[model samples]
Target: MRCLIAEDHLLSRRVLKELLSPDFDCDIAVNGREAIDSFVLAHEAKRPYDVILMDIMMPEIDGMEALKSVRSLEKKMQIPSHLAVKVIMITALGDPHTVIKSFNECEADSFIVKPLTRHKLATELRKLNVLK
Candidate 1:
């Protein structure tokens, strides 16, 4: 599967890529703006990403805003049935309010806390049916 990872922290991005390398084709974005641009480009290129891992805090644009934009585009474009994209919010903040907001407001497929263990991430992927 193809995945897009957006994080401002370089180390965190690297760690996520390393963890997902064995199971997915990964693309890295340094900030939310880059992430959105990359996502749009990939979609336009007819190679839409299967999943997106988004960090809430970022420069140029925040993950929540980026996700809203992505959803808007998806709605406006009336993306075909075959081009479904799932987005997962990944961040260090474990605030219940934020988690609730992410789910209610951003419509994320799932949320994951940082310092992610391989097992935890794998379990999430499996639950989402992105992994077998």
Candidate 2:
């Protein structure tokens, strides 16, 4: 699988890369704007990511905004819902409101609360059927 990890923290990004790179082709973006650019570039290149791990609190644009943009882009491109990139919100915020917003408004495929663990990530991916 191809994955984009959008995280502002250096250590978190590094750890996520390490965990995912073993099984996926992983790319890193430090913030939401960069994540959007990378996503667009990949799509334009016909090499769209299969999954995105987006951090909710980033400089410039936030993950919620980025997720909306990504879904909009997919809609604009007329990509079928099944073919749309799966987005998993990665956030330190564990509040019910944020979680509800992620799923209800942003329409994330899944979520992982920080501090992220390999098992938790794998479980979410499994729920999405991104992993066996």
Candidate 3:
């Protein structure tokens, strides 16, 4: 499996990479723009990511805008809904409003509060069927 971890915080990026390393070949993006670029490049290379863990806050572009762009790109590519990359929005904000916005606005497949743990990730992966 391939995964993209998009976060600006260095420590958080390291932790997420470590957590996902066992199962996925990981790519790191420090900001939302980089994440979007990685997404496009991966597809061009015929190795599109199976999952993306996106942070809501970042430099340049915020995760929400990045997420929208990604979804739009997928649509333009004519990728079916089921074939689109599974997106899990990650953030420190656990508020219901933010969570609802993530899902309602960007079509995120899951949302994970910060201090991301193995269990939370695994559960979401299973639900998304990115993990069997």
By lDDT, who's the top model here?
A: 3
Residue 111 CA displacement from its true place in model 3, Å:
0.2
* lDDT tens readout by residue for model 2, 14-123: 99999898789999999999999999999999899999999999999999999999999899999999999999999999999999999999999987889899999999
Write candidate 3's Cα lDDT for 1-132 as tens digits.
Answer: 999999999999999999899999999999999999999999999999999999999999999899999999999999999899999999999999999999999999999997889999999999999888
Residue 3's lDDT in candidate 1:
93
Model 3 lDDT vs. the true structure? Answer: 0.95
Candidate 3 root-mean-square deviation in Å: 0.7
Candidate 2 has a TM-score of: 0.98
- Candidate 1 residue spans exceeding 4 A from truth: 80-83
Misplaced by over 4 Å in model 2 are none
lDDT (C-alpha) at residue 60 in model 2: 96
Native-referenced Cα lDDT, model 2: 0.93
Instruction: Give Cα distance to truth, residue 42, candidate 3, Å.
Output: 0.6
The lDDT values for all models are 0.87, 0.93, 0.95
TM-score of each: 0.94, 0.98, 0.98
